[model samples]
Target: MKKAVLINDTTYDYHHGCEAVVSGIKSSLLVRGVEVIASCPVGVHYKKMNNIEKAIQQSDLIVVNGEGTIHHGREKAKWLLEVSAYAKKYNTPSVLINATYQDNPAEFDKLLNDFDLVYVRESESYDYLKQRGIEAGFAPDLTMLLSQTISLPEYQSRNGIGITDSPKVQEGMWNFQMAMKHGWTFLPVLRSYRAEGEKSATEVLRHLKHLFTNIGWINKENGVSEESYLRARNRFLCYTVSEYLKKVSGLQILLASRFHSLCFAIVTETPFLATSGNSYKVEGLLRDVGLSSRICELSDFDDIADYNAYSFSDEEKIKIKEYKKSSLIKINNMFDKLVGLTG
Candidate 1:
């Protein structure tokens, strides 16, 4: 068996969207007869970890799950891309996938060439990589690969508009208020699966945060609008992946603020529109599908009726279905090339 080390195994986030990415990467490699001999989580710095070098040295492949981490040339990205340089020392092949390559330092660009393969999640990233002289494949975020395994449930009764959170906190609160003002559903898009009492310190901190945020005024950093904030946070606390998708698939339309929420919307074939997020991902993805008009701003919130009961257009439905289908096929091919399984 070809031993491989999966770096950036990001599944600590019990969020199903994140889980899908990790699962897609691992399963693709497994089917290729590659064994994940060891793995590393997202939080740790790989260079500082004493065992990382040994893991990389013993493996035939080093797979980096570059999910949203390669942009900005930050310390974390440097640590991740450095893996390619490290693997070269042992004559092992390294690959980076599901990445978003944006404005990064000119120096880090050289580090990219060492990868045997690089697959980006959006066109913008692919363009960026090509401009920098890296032969990178363009693929949608691996979360879409979930559509192949967890097929959309049979359509049944779907209810009113549902709103999800944002990378930006203020926008999240605004999302809650808008959902409440119209008596729509407030779907919390990202939540961990850990039981509440599992971590006492984390539990205590959450209680303190909730109590602190309940103090009336909408402090941009400290809090949001009145009771809606408290109520939404309480309701947002937990979900199994099954419950999360069931709720997402049942929504008539979802106004999303997070990138993964849009992925959830696509997989479930739920109607959705998205606002600006902390990164270019939302805009990049919508544009790729030729649905850039779906991008909305808070100023346009009241005018939401323009897209009421919005569903994908016949053309967009075709585009999205094809766009989504490519994710898995591309992922499988990336692995095939990695292990020389490409026929």
Candidate 2:
């Protein structure tokens, strides 16, 4: 059997979206008859180079699942640089998947040039890599693969509205006002999980450091906690990805600033208004599936009624379904090529 080492540095203890992305990649590989080895599990630091190198050496292919992590100066970028370097030194066929590039093109020259294939999830990153003379392919986010493996729950919609919190956009008050005006049940979906007393002292200290480092950006007076702004809503927060998906499936509409919240809405076939967060990840995914019309700004909240009225036509739904199929095909074809190369 073919062996593949999947390296997603955040899969173990990240938000449900991260878990979904990792699971989607693994499911796609498993169905293709590949044995998977995850390089980074929760609580294990990526600095463990010996273990990572051993896994790469034992695998037929190395996959760097840089899920929106190739941005400038981010810790994930540093980790990618390290792993890509190891893959090169070990002479393994490596592929970078579902990554977004926000750093200078020059900084990524060596890493991008060394990869056997680079699959970017967003058009902006694709174009950026292309302009810098890197051969990059554009594909939808891997999370779309979840639609294939999971079935949407059957729930009666009571015209409920779901909203996600984002540091980049503070639309909590506006969303709450709209929910009240429309008499829709308000749901706050927490994308990331916070462990109360389950973490070690070092981990807790790291989290506290992050909280204080970004204190200016956090709105404590608005009841937005340091952990996540969604805590302010505190009404109905879905902790797990499954819960979030079921909650979104039941909602008539979602006003989401989190990227994965939008992903869940898409998978659940729930209509939503997406606010662009700190990056183009949200708008880029919508544009890829021909749903750019759903993009909304904070100011657009004043006309929430118009957005609530918007619904996807049967043709549009078909387009999304077809696009999802194509995405899975792309992933499978890439792996096939890798297997052929390694074989």
Candidate 3:
């Protein structure tokens, strides 16, 4: 069996960027009969550099789940360089899969310059690679690959109105209000689930006041054991808001600030207004899928309803499907290329 090592340098939230990429890698490698061993388990901090090195030594290939190399300062980038050097020392073939360089250009070039394969998640990363003379190619988020393994909610009954979160929440609500005027059930669903301590969701709700009708918050780091996860996974109303996702299935329209929340909507094929934080990673994913236009500016909050309606168009919806398809194809090709390298 082809043993692969996946390094997930992230806090094990319920759903995170690295976890998502790892999921994609797992699915792709499974198809090619490869076994993967992630160095850090979910919710476990990876402080042991020795363990990561050992995993790399035992594997036929190494995959650094894309979350860019460094951020804030150069601390994470430093760690990444250490790991990359270790991989090179052992001659372990490494693949940087689905990464977003949310870092300084100089730093990104330095960290990503030496790699067997670098699968970029956005055009910016690809262009950056070109400028720096690094071997890199653009690919979509692994969440798109979920299309094959997961069943999304069917668009069985799309209510005329769709409510979203962020400042653009008003736009979705206004549309829903219009639909409600015609006798429809119009409710705006907002979810908040960061590793933030208790009451984060409540705080957001309090801030939103009466704008949001449905609110859900989940802090996954609190309890994420095998049994706890299973229970949370199986619970009808896990974390208070999962019920909405479970009930709405495919028909719920989401306007979200969180990445995984948006990802949940994508896996469900539920149309949404992805409220981008101050991060290029989100925008990169949106651009890859041709849905960049669906994002709303924070400044648009005052007249969110108007802004959402003004900016969102039929063209954006058409691009969603196209981006999804292209993302999957790009990732599949990356996997095929990596598998060939190992063989």
Candidate 4:
């Protein structure tokens, strides 16, 4: 079996979205008979460089989960640079998977050039890597590929809605604020996984306490049992924010702040609208789907009813299905090409 090492510093403790992304990458690789070993930047602090070095020595390929570096921050940029340098040392078939586009330092650019295959989720991102002269291709998000496995329960009730910690909400309140405009009861599901002394959690909890009467906060501080995790998996509606689309399949509409939430919405065939978070990549992905109107910028929500004026007809439904099919075909083909699985 070809051995592969998955590198991502993301954990499920707080970022459930990343947790799902990692899970999707691993699950997909496993199905192809790839012996997969996973590691994160946090491991570097404890196991030291020797741990990743040893894995690199034994692996046939190195897959870097690039979502960790989309933001404009020193720490994220540094992490990308360090990981790239380490991966290059092995001369393995290194692939940067599901990364968003971001401006980085010269060293970061140099590190990107070292990849054997670079798969981005957006065409704009494909253009980005090509501009930098990195061998790149576009693939739908791995999360979108895995969402196909979701079997939604019959939504027997319309009691609640869900949203994630997106700073953009304060600006684009129409999607969440104007819920009554479309005759659906909006129940906001708010979750927090902040560690002790984190003010952001406290602030979000305070605001959400008023916005949502029903909360689904998963406290990793309490720790997650195997049973709880399984139960969470079964309850499609209570899926992590990205999985929200699957859970709310029966709802008339979904409005969200997170990227995966919109993705879930499409996968579940649920009518949904979203406000862009701090990430422009989410906006770019939405544009690729031809649902740019679905992305309400903080500035665009000045009139929540604007979206109400748009027609939601069978034509729109056809568009959603076509988009989903096209994206999945590309994603699956990429996997086949990567593994040389041609029949």
Candidate 5:
């Protein structure tokens, strides 16, 4: 069996949407009969370069899960560069899967050139890399592929809104308040990892301290000091990707700020109004699906009602279905070439 090492931004944290991306990549590799040997988070794995080198030496391929990691942020991008360098040194084939780029194009060109193949999750990143003279192909986010196999639970639609809260946007709180004032049964959804798999007692305590400290202000504002208001409102806390998708499928609409929250909305066909966060991933994705009008900036909260009233057209649904088919074919073709899989 051809051995592969799967590296991602965070693999063990189930709370983050990237966890689902990792799962999807691993599933795709396994379906191709590749033996996945090492799976580790980039932050923790980069500290032990010697171990990474050893793993690369033993593996036939180095598969990096580049889900939105190649942005202006120095940390994750630096880690990917180092990993690519190690793969090149070991003369092992490497491929970056389902990535997006928002940083220095020249730097990305140099880094991506080291990989044998590069697959981006959206056109913006694909064009960015191609314009920089790097050969990159476009593929949909891996989570969409995973969602294809998932069987969502049948639930009666309550016609209520679901709100995903992020610390990056203060206006998200106002949106939440508005939902409550309107008596909408808004489900609070958290797409961030909350350290649920920490093994050490000290680590657990540290995570709890961090979580409470961050959300304590919101609790105070709501006059609920005993527990976090966000925590109390969260309907999908600590849920696996499958469970989260099933839960999201029941919602009538979604108000999302996080990129993956928008992905879930798309996968479930749940109409959503998105607020821009730290990156253009959300806007780029909505534009790709012909739903650019669905994007609402943080300052545009006053127009929330207009956003809520928006619905997907039959033509848009048909477009999404066609996109999903073509995207999956691209991914499957990549895997077949890499692992020599016959289907």
Candidate 6:
């Protein structure tokens, strides 16, 4: 049987979006008869893993889940890229997929060039790789590749808007306050299990930390207390990812700040309006789907009624349809090339 090693595997990360990406990648390979022998998690030193060296040495391929990791000269990016070098050393084919490449060090070009193929999640990264003379293709993030695995909603059944978390506290504050001001749902992109009832002492401490850290912008308000934000946040917390996705899908529109939330909006064909994320990731995604005009400034949030009439254009719908269709085809071709199957 053909064997493969997955580097930067994020299935265990517990973020619903991360899990979707890993699951899509894994299932893609599995259906092709590739047995993934070793999956090195994010932040782990791929080369130092005791069994990893042996796995790659005997494997037919190495695939890196470059999801949001290969930019800004991060140590994790360096470690993950070194897997390609190891594959080169062992004469095994290597591929990097689902990446957002932006403002990265020029040295990364050399590392990227080592890959048998590089598939970025957006065209900005695709253009960057092309300029640097690397073999590359661009597709929707792997999160979108899971669209077939779930149910989507009909337009007539959807109503209201939802705003989700942001990596930036101030951005998160804007989302939270906007949802409250507009009487919209504040969906948390972070997944947590609530079936166990009371959280452990450790989880309690984490929630305490989450509360304190989340209070930074709220203190400026006259009547808001530290616990107020935490209490409000908990009210809408979801017990499962499927439930969360269903909630997002039911929205008439999503005012999102997280990259994955935007992906969820696209997966459910929910029209979205977004703000900046930590990087160009959000803008890049909107650009990919031909919805670049949907990115709004904070001032635009003042009147929720303004966006009440917002929805996808006929042209934008076609662009989204093309994105979904072409991304699936590109991803299929990517794996065929990876495993040396006749394309």
TM-scores for every candidate against the unseen true structure: 0.85, 0.78, 0.68, 0.71, 0.82, 0.85
Candidate 6 residue lDDT tens string, 265-331: 8877788888776568788888877889999876675566855577877887788878887878877
Please report the candidate that would top lDDT against the real structure: 6
| 1-343: candidate 2 lDDT, tens digit per residue | 7788877645554466776777767766776777777566533445575676677888878877877767765655666755666777778878888887766446666667778878888888887777788898766777777777676546446355666655443466556545555555555544334432246677556544544443234343453433453433543455557777887777777878778878878887887888886667877787777888889887775566654476678877887777777877876676566566566
Residue by residue across 196-282, what tens digits does model 3's lDDT show?
243566645643443332322323224233433222222222232344454434343554555655665665566666666545767
Model 1 scores a TM of: 0.85
Question: Ranking by TM-score, best first?
Answer: 1, 6, 5, 2, 4, 3
Instruction: For candidate 4, write residues 218-295 as lDDT tens digits.
Output: 333453344443233222223244434445565555666666656666777666667765557777777787777777
Write down the lDDT of every candidate, Cα atoms only.
0.74, 0.68, 0.56, 0.58, 0.66, 0.75
Residue 76 accuracy (lDDT) in model 5: 61
Better of 1 and 4 by TM-score: 1
RMSD in order of candidates? 4.4, 5.7, 9.4, 8.8, 4.3, 4.4
User: What lDDT is reached at residue 15 by model 3?
Assistant: 36
Clashes of 4: 3
Residue 215 Cα positional deviation in candidate 3, in Å, after optimal superposition: 10
What candidate 2 gets wrong by more than 4 Å, as runs, is: 41-45, 73-75, 152-158, 167-235, 306-308
TM-score, predicted candidate 6 vs. hidden true structure: 0.85
Show the colliding residue pairs in model 2.
none
Compared with the true structure, the alpha-carbon lDDT of candidate 4 equals: 0.58
Over 4 Å off, model 3? 9-11, 16-20, 41-50, 68-73, 105-108, 150-153, 159-252, 299-314
Q: Per-residue lDDT of 124-159 in model 5, one digit per residue for the tens?
A: 777777777778777778777755675544543536
- Global Cα lDDT for candidate 2: 0.68
How displaced is residue 103 in candidate 1, in Å?
A: 0.6
